[model samples]
Target chain A: MLYLIGMGLHDERDLSLKAVEALRGCERVYLESYTSCFNGDINRLQEMLGKEVVLLDRKDLEENPEENVLAGGEVGLIVMGDPMVATTHSDLVLRAREKGAEVKVIHSSSVYSAIAETGLQIYKFGRTTTIAYPEGDYFPKSPYEALKENHMRGLHTLLLLDVKADEGRYMTVNEGIKYLLMMEESCLQNQFKKDSKCVGVARLGGDTAIRYGTAEEVIKEEFGGPPHILIVPGKMHYMEEEMLKAYEV
Target chain B: MLYLIGMGLHDERDLSLKAVEALRGCERVYLESYTSCFNGDINRLQEMLGKEVVLLDRKDLEENPEENVLAGGEVGLIVMGDPMVATTHSDLVLRAREKGAEVKVIHSSSVYSAIAETGLQIYKFGRTTTIAYPEGDYFPKSPYEALKENHMRGLHTLLLLDVKADEGRYMTVNEGIKYLLMMEESCLQNQFKKDSKCVGVARLGGDTAIRYGTAEEVIKEEFGGPPHILIVPGKMHYMEEEMLKAYEV
Candidate 1:
């Protein structure tokens, strides 16, 4: 049996009681650390579950899932957010099942829904996009284009920042804003403006810090850490405006 | 301090360790029961947390939030799924804050992200809409229009089935499909086809059941009970197609 569990967001205590109970009965536990940023203390998690958790990189889970799945016992693969949110884990489920392993998924909190803490309407959100830290000339402008389309439709966009967890590199919201500005300069798309209001969220689910301001203000403001998300609101309802006031810097 | 905690999906054990610990210290715990359907045993939750959970309706939360907030002590308002996903809760947060109450949200798993378990790319979803149980002339066709727009944009739509939890009435997937088809007939829009493929998901996060098939097939197929959601997939990637096969009936 392979149990794909979600560690939710933030600390080990973010894990559900069901997850804790299941981890106690697992023979082997592996935490996939490359996908998302989870600053939780592994030793604390180990103490709570009474199980030894081995860390697995992107290659271990993506290229060589069989090595983990073929263990032939109750193996647990802990994902940072909801287990199947990443397509890689979904493929892992198929691979595990094909290898004659019974798979069970224990879902937990994900940044996708937790973004509502910013008081932005979830249903009003359009297709979510990610802003990656450009290496050399490998910058991508598709995220900017997607946000542009959502803006045109008067829908909000949740921009997820790239995280290279293995390298201890997490893209800050400030960097994400700068990337958008760079894209605007290159593409000459008049979508993003200096005074455009956006919301920057940091460390959600555990003592979160949220600030709502224009692109100029947000880019200059210090959000104070990783696991940051940017929300570009398109059209705001009066009620939404009222709720956002609580987070305005 | 007012703590808005999420119970996740399904049962009592689905509550996160953080939620449990917070509830233990809470002087008043009220479960908002009108928004979504949570078939979890309340007694079991009380037994586990050692706290008696009170039930709050839409009126208690919306019209008179002071009843839940003015306690001048730590109050926990337990919500099914992620605490702030519903705009009503966001309004509650604002109201609580206005009443000089400090607010902290404990996030949990939500159907918004859990639907990715069906192999649909979460980023490809656009503008989620809900299908309400038609009441007399109050039948709305906006959900169908939203799904049509998503289809045009080659984006998937997550149709949340409306639940009247207070009345003990939950909308089934079959009723949701029928509602869409009825909307199509009234609007004279050829937006939906009988042979169009759709995914019906039920009781996610606990004993989850998924079935993928054409609208004709899914509508005729019984998906057991309540708390069902429908997914209308757009252009599918080959990997998504392969992953969805596991759910195809």
Candidate 2:
């Protein structure tokens, strides 16, 4: 049996009882460490489950799943947020099933749903984009293009800051804002404005801090941590505006 | 203090340990019962928490929140899926803050992220829409329009089937597919074809069932219960296509 469990959004306590129960019964547990940040304590998680949690790198799990992940016994792979959100995990599930291994997915909170804390309606949000730290000349304009498309349709855009957990690198909200400014400069698109209202959410599903303001103001506010996400709003209803008031800088 | 807790995608066990602990400390607990269907046994939930869980209707929770939900006590309002996904819950949080009530939200899995179980990338999905059991002379064109918009952008569309939990009326996959066909007929748009591929997901997070096929074939499939969600693919990456093949009929 191969179990794909979600660590949810915060500490170990964020895991569902169902997940904990599944973890307690697993023979070996491996935590996927590359996709998203795991805010929980590994020691405490292991203590609670009475199992030694091994860290699984992206390459090892993706490249040699049969040997490292599905070696006959009941093995559990823990993933940050909901397990299947990443294509890699879904691919692993497909691989496991093809090898005749029973796969069980234990679901939990993901950033996709936790963004609701920003008071933005999930339905009003368009395609989600990620702003990665541009390496060399590899800066892509897809994120900015996606923002333009969403903004044109009067929709909110969720900008997921890139996370290189393996390299101890995580994009801050301010960095994401800077990337957006650069995108605006390069694309010369009127979609993003320095004065446009934006919502910066940091440490979501934990000790969360939400700030609502223009790019100028929000960039100055201290969010106090990593794993920050930015939202660029297109249009809002009166109720959404009222909710944003609570977070206004 | 007011605690808004998510019951996650499935049953009582789907509640995080944090949620269970919060419920234990609450002086009163109220379950929001209108927006979505609750799949778990209420009695089991109450028993597990050692607290009586009361159901709150839409009118009461929205109109008389002060007296019904925020009456100077540590109250917890349990919601299906994530607490803030619906605009109503976000409005409640705003109202509570205005009344000087401290609010804490415990996040969990929602259809927005749970749809990842369908093997589609969350980022590849566009704005989500709902297909309601149309009332006489009150049918809306927004859902079909949203589908067209998403399809044109080469983004997948998550069509949330409406649920009138109070009336015990949950839109099945077949009903949602039929609604799409109706929209195509009415608009004479090439966006939704009768032979277009569709994915229907039922009972997400517990006893889950997923089927992928053409509209005609998927509509003929027995999804086995309420709380079913449909996905209309706009464009597929090779990896996504491989994953969908696992669910193909």
Name the TM-score of candidate 2.
0.98
lDDT tens string, model 1, B1-249?
999999998777889999999999999888987888777898888888787888888887788777665556989989999999999988887877887889899999999999988889898998999999888889989898888888888999999999888788888888888888888788877776778889999999887889999889989878887789999898899888988898887
Error of 2 at B23 (Å): 0.9
Q: List the residue pairs that clash in candidate 2.
A: none
Q: After superposing candidate 1, which stretches have Cα over 4 Å from the reference? A: none
Off by over 4 Å in 2: none
Top of the candidates by lDDT: 2
**Candidate 2 residue lDDT tens string, B44-83:** 9999989899999888898998877888798999999999
- For model 1 the local lDDT of residue A128 reads 95
Error of 2 at B106 (Å): 0.6
Mark the 10 consecutive residues where model 2 chain B has the least summed lDDT: B65-74
Q: What's the CA error at residue A85 for candidate 2, in Å?
A: 0.9
Cα TM-score per model: 0.98, 0.98
